[model samples]
Target: MTIRLAAVAAPFGRDLDECFATIERLAFRARSEGASVLALPEACLGGYLANLGGEAAGPPALRRDGPELARLAGIAGDMVICAGYCEAEGDLRFNSVVCVTGDGILGHHRKVHQPLRENQSYAAGDGFTAFDTPAGRMGMMICYDKAFPESARSLALDGAQIVVCVSAWPASRTDPAPDLADDRWTRRFDLFDQARALENQVVWVSSNQSGTFGDLRFVGRAKIVGPGGEILAATGVSAGVAVASLDLEETLATARRSMGHLRDRRPEAYAAGF
Candidate 1:
């Protein structure tokens, strides 16, 4: 089915009310543009960590069944919205994402891969899974998860036609590039988005935090990439929404017609590491 998808790149801080306002504004904009699915940046609800250091306290931990997510679902209305927040489970907190519509929650994903001092703040997730949504069969991941090919691959193997990766990725700390576009981390961010989509032959939606947050400077390059690794819509290095329209079945058919990446996978060939 044909669907309009929007990936967001905007700044979100520690304030929940302010973040909801931003999400409401952006959701309205996307809905007006006929978007069926909207992907918000990682930690867009309560904000990401000030730094990768273990010293800083984490964002407010929210429950999946709490009023915050319920409010988010109400704001979502008919549109499928994917957003990140700190998930609370008793004394432990997890870096997680949730997909919801006006009716209720559809899917949830806890970020499986932790980078640097992230493990110090939150417990790690154990697996990757795909679930059905109004838009299509979808999967989610956060920040550093996209770096590993296995993450996206696992989703695709689980029947995800589209993958949304929300991030709070920042530019390099040492020897930072004068131009954000030339920054190595920014380049890696873009490369991972394209490479994951191309290798798995799935539609890729990448959303990231924009502007500086405490000690880290985020690279806003939100984009919708086609299964062929072509960028359909991108916000470049600024805060904005990248929107695109395409027929999921047709797009996947076109990309997989000749040499299907999933069809030709040699899982048996690589038994040592995987």
Candidate 2:
């Protein structure tokens, strides 16, 4: 079945109300364009902690069934939303993503990788798994999670046809690029999106924060990738939505037919610790 996918690279800042408003606005725009699944950047609910310390950087840790998520689900309506937020479980906090519809959450994932002092505020996720959604078998990943190949590979092994990665990824920490589009981080983001899709023969959705937050400047390169590693649509260093339509099953079938990367896997060739 052909379905439209969208990724929002717009910044929502740290205001909860404003974040919600932005989500609704962008979601409406996506729906108007016929996007069924919309991927918003990590921390889109309340923005991300740029330079704040543990205590000062608390980005509203919402529970999976909390009112905040319920509200998000309400706005989600028929469109499936895959977005990142800070998850609160008891007294612990996690950088997490939830795939939701009007019914509720379809799947939830906590980020497994921690860069810098992110661990100071959020606990890392344990594993990667895929779940059935209206869009297809889908999986979730956060910013740093995509840096590791095993993360997406695990989801693909679990029968995921589409993988959504929401990120608040910043530009080069030290040397700022004269042109945001030419930034190294921007290149890395695009490379990861393509590599992950091609390697697993799965559709890839990557969303990131655009503009500046604190001392960090985001490289808004939100994109949608086909199973064959083609960039179907992209938002380059701008706060906007990228949308593309594809025959979900047909694309995957054609990509895997010639080079069945998953089916021809040689798991025995590598050691677990490698």
Candidate 3:
């Protein structure tokens, strides 16, 4: 059976109420379009802070069991939704993503890599993992997590057939791009999506925030990548949704048929230091 999937590139600003409202509208649209799975950007529930500095960079911290995520899950009924947010566990905050269905949360993954002074604002998660859901076996990763090859590889080894990477990824922070699409950061983002999908032979769904926030201008290139590293659908440099259909089992079988990257392992031969 083929199931429709969508990755959204849209804006969700500072206000909690407004953010939820935007998510609702998008969820309604996805349902109408027959999307069985939806992926939203990192920190989509609250605006990403302008700077990761003392006192100024704190985005609103929400608990995993909080009303916010519950409200998101309410809209998620049937359609599996993977979305990013700032997670508050006691006093520590972590950049995180949660996957939900009508039933409830299937998995929650905290952003494992802290870029620049991102560690100044959020605590780091320990590792990577994949989980089971109504849709299929899947893994979740936040923005910076996808930069590392091991992040996706670990999930693949854990039996994940599909990996959802949600980001609040912005255009070049230093040398700003005249066009968001031409930015080096945007290019790297696309490359990572394709490499991760092909290397692991897993379906990749990439979603990001669109428009500008504080000093940042996000590159909205949300896409659905096939196991062969081909883009099935994409929303180029704009606030839009990228949709594609995948016959889960068959797709995986075909991608791994001739040369299974995971099966042809050389983990023992490679040095730990890259």
Give the top-scoring candidate (TM-score). 1
Question: TM-score rank, highest first?
Answer: 1, 2, 3
lDDT of 2 at 178: 96
TM-scores of all predicted structures:
0.98, 0.97, 0.97
Give the whole-model CA lDDT for all candidates, comma-separated.
Answer: 0.95, 0.91, 0.91
**lDDT of candidate 1 over 1-274, digit per residue (tens):** 7899999999999999999999999999999999999999999999999988874677989999999999999999999999999999998899999999999999999998998988889999998999999788999999899999999999999999999999999999997899998999999999999999999999999999999998999999999999999999999888999999999999999999999999998878998778
Q: Residue 104's C-alpha lDDT in candidate 2? A: 91
lDDT of 2 by residue, 137-246 (tens): 99999998999999999999999999999999999988778999999988998999999999999999999999988778999999999988999999989998999999
The residue pairs in collision within model 2 are none
Better of 1 and 2 by TM-score: 1
TM-score of 2: 0.97
Candidate 1: where is the Cα deviation over 4 Å? Answer: none
lDDT of 2: 0.91
What is the C-alpha lDDT profile of model 3 across 22-105, one tens digit per residue? 998889999999999999999998978676554465678999998989999999988999988989999899899999987778
Name the weakest run of 10 consecutive residues (lDDT summed) in model 1: 51-60
